[model samples]
Target chain A: MASTMLRTSALRSTIRATPTVASKRARLAGVSFVRGKATLPDLPYDYGALEPAINGKIMELHHSKHHNTYVTSYNQAIEKLQEAQQAQDIAGQIALKPLINFHGGGHINHTLFWENLAPKNQGGGEPPSGSLSKAIDGSFGSLDAMKQKFNTALAGIQGSGWAWLVQDTQTGSISIKTYANQDPVVGQFRPILGIDAWEHAYYLQYQNRKAEYFSAVWDVVNWKAAEKRFK
Target chain B: MACNLTPLISPQALEPHISAQIMTLHHTKHHQTYITNLNAALGKLSTAVSTSDITTQVALQPAIRFNAGGHINHSLFWLNLSPPSSPDAKSSAAPQLTSAINKKWGDMETFKSAFNTQLLGIQGSGWGWLVKEEGKNDLRIMTTKDQDPVVEAGLVPVFGVDMWEHAYYLQYNNVKADYVKEIWSVINWKVAEERFLGAQKNAFGMLKASM
Candidate 1:
């Protein structure tokens, strides 16, 4: 009986959140983000703040353009997904998932991507302090050791993916993990830091050399921001 | 990459007791097909993302969810079996993984029996898993249907057993029970231990543990 109630509640939430095509389409035609739709987060600093490390052109493209595309597509997918559900189009909903995963992942990744970065002028590139720094030493032996291990793991990515510093649920210490494409760190592992390894992330400045990009991103890592996140 | 089809182990290691031909065909043919299928599924997922044709909810999600599950499950299945690492040893003993399992699940015999019993009870194609779940930091047993990962269940996978037919067909044919019994001989406890200790560390900092 309890399970049935839970299932009914789930079904109710699903129905309540069902998309209205009229509103969804109306919101999409506009350039601005809609409330309850996808909203473009405000940049903490000017677009050119993280110059040289992540250049103005890359930031402009990554944010105003690329992230916007994901936001638009995600809203559209959700709208269609709701319609499909309402119509009992099981086959249609099944088909729409990649868009949701990709675009939804795009939104998720970019949201973190923006906050994770900061200008070196504003204390970026600094290493973690306090318990985080100590934990880093304990797990990987030293800060440099952790960086080397992370770089090796990042460079080892065969294709487009993400390199992450994630909290292990059981151990409660940070560990470096890599995921191919947009596979999220997911579940209980809290993301302390993440570096995007997608070609678009560093293609303009570094060209094809991922290792160089991996090395360079360290300069604008926003360690102060990372330290704040650990708590 | 393509599954290393030629041969990974010597046939003579499991000989007389377990035939060389059976091991060869099982690893090279059956497991290889799963790898190929998994790759194909991933490729389809990529295509869906690129094309943007997935305008509905039902179209591409199932492919990504199901095929990714298939890939992960099959990959683990192939890694589960082996010939006894030493001649004098009990074929089923996995020295590397046993101590950790003992630490968590009481003792080797108990853990093995429980795991195999769960494996025997699976209603259909699914997996039997030993996962480490966090909450005071401990290992736990979890079973999942189809190809769903323990990670999705919010646990770190310590050990896994795939009950899918392709895993057992070449050797035991229709008799899954015999195949499950046979696989215990070659369990790689070493890799399992590494994963265990790694999970034991406050990895990625989400848990409340001291370094």
Candidate 2:
């Protein structure tokens, strides 16, 4: 009975969120039920700010072209999903799930990625000083050790993916995890920092020597941002 | 079977079109890792089969498909390229395949334009292939996402272009159109012709030979 009620409410919310239905209801009641659209988040610093570690051209393309594509694709997927829901097309809705997950995850991951970096002069690469530092020390013995493990995890990724430093929400234990493609870190884990392992991330500057790119990225990692997420 | 197949053409042979640095790393590091993972997955699969572990067997399907497809695709990719200086690089080297392509798209230029459109249309990691349809002379352009090989019965993959960022990012950066344009110069038409005219088994015989 509880599950049935929960399922019915979920279906009710879906119908309420449909634009055509919502707009008609809005005209009657003067209340809007439309959800806000996802948009590309602005980067915290100038494109060239991370220079030498990551080039301005790579940064520009990564944000404007790559991340923007994800934003646009995710929005399109959401629109199609709404149309499918309105048509009561179960197969169409099922097929759109992966697209929504991939593009949506891409947007979410890249937004966090932009925040997880900073220019060298702006407190980037500085070791965490607060409880986050203690947590890292407790988990991996030292900052350097944790970084080494993180880099190793990044290296082991088979294809396009991300390596994340996450804290288990239940246990508050920090560890390294890798995800394939654009899968977001979810369910019991809080993502503190993420490093994109896709070739587009460093291929321009590092070429095939990805280990160099991996090591260089640490020089610009925004520990303060990570610390904020940790708390 | 051990995954020890070597490229028919030397790594540096495709330079200018594709740099030696990219080729060497693509072959040595990236493709090698796929081979290693495929072997490991096969070993685990054998164990699961022997132990009758249906759950483990089911779990291993994706790894097996991904790694095996990677090996197959890379193997075909290497053979599908030729040095620009080689006679095999010329479209004239593939009379039968060229006629088929001309039949399908009206001319070579139109065919390549259509193929490039499909190549660039791929989002994220993938491959664009020119495949010969089942039991017919009909040809089609198709794109497969992330290491997926063309393995449908009777459809022969004449050749494929890797559209992964690693395939061109070092040289072309985000200008993928340039990479797609340049790759035509090094395409091994001779190998493609053979795959087009030959049986499906012949197209995959390289895998059997390696085994």
Candidate closest to the true structure, highest lDDT: 2
Chain B alone vs. reference chain B, TM-score for every model: 0.69, 0.97
lDDT of 1 by residue, B44-80 (tens): 6567668775763345555445545555554554344
Off by over 4 Å in 2: A1-37, A82-90, B1-21, B24-71, B83-123, B131-156, B181-186, B204-211
List, residue by residue over A1-231, the lDDT tens digit for candidate 2: 354335323422331233564456445765433554566666767899999899998999999988888878887898788778778898999999888888888887888888778788877788888999999999999999999999999987756899999999999999999998899998999999999998999987887688999999999998877887895
For model 1, chain A alone compared with the true chain A gives a TM-score of: 0.81
10 residues in a row with least lDDT, candidate 1 chain A = A8-17
- By summed lDDT, the worst window of 10 consecutive residues in model 2 chain A runs over A8-17
Kindly report the fnat of each predicted structure, to 2 decimals: 0.00, 0.29
